[model samples]
Target: MALSTSNRAAPSSYLSLGEVAAELGITDRTVRNYVARGVLPAHRIKGSRLIRVRRSDVDALLQPVPVTDGGDAA
Candidate 1:
């Protein structure tokens, strides 16, 4: 018998608070604040009190900064 493969992508792994902070170049407290403010979504582990965030969620926080051209205005 041959195994069947699906065209679906694998699920993303969860990230710890520290990991999320490092990824965003921010402090863990900031990450916690984001979670508290409902800006970032977090999940609780099934059997533990530990909380985790998805990489996709972290990536979602990344937004392109608007660049302004240095020009003199009259």
Candidate 2:
């Protein structure tokens, strides 16, 4: 007997907290906490937690912080 393959295609990118953490070089718990704290948005698929952070968001987070002099420059 031969098995049949479905025509469905796999998702391009759906990540769990662990996967997101690995990608961002952070701890899994940090990802979860960020989700909980509403810093990062996440969605639930079926019954598992799925976090889908865009590359832009990651880049924004990785951007260098701006430095301010003690004088009022406005």
Candidate 3:
């Protein structure tokens, strides 16, 4: 049977804390820190302590910063 569009879950990439830490070249604890600071969105399984971070949320943090014009330069 074909699944209904309304019943489909949104497409999203999720990574374990260790996986995210490896991808970012940081420690797992650091990933946890980001989650604690609300810098990254995360979720934990019911009755489990494991945390998962959304890949899109991590990508948002990697966005390039815009450069400013020299108009305000002394």
Q: Say which candidate scores most in lDDT.
A: 1
Worst 10 residues of 1 by lDDT: 1-10
RMSD per model, one decimal = 10.5, 10.4, 8.4
Highest TM-score: which candidate?
3
lDDT of 2 by residue, 1-74 (tens): 11122233324444556777887899988887876776666555433333455445455666789987889767
* 1-74: candidate 3 lDDT, tens digit per residue: 11112222333476778888998999988887887777777776445555666788778878987988869667
For model 3, state the Cα shift of residue 13 in Å.
1.7
- What's the TM for model 3? 0.70
Off by over 4 Å in 3: 1-12, 69-71
lDDT of 2 at 62: 68
lDDT of 1 at 67: 88
In model 3, the worst 10-residue window by lDDT is: 1-10
How many clashing residue pairs, candidate 2? 0
lDDT of 1 by residue, 1-74 (tens): 11123333324576788999998999999988888888888776555656777788788889676889879877
Residue 23 in candidate 1 has what lDDT?
88
Which stretches of candidate 1 lie above 4 Å from their native place?
A: 1-12, 65-74
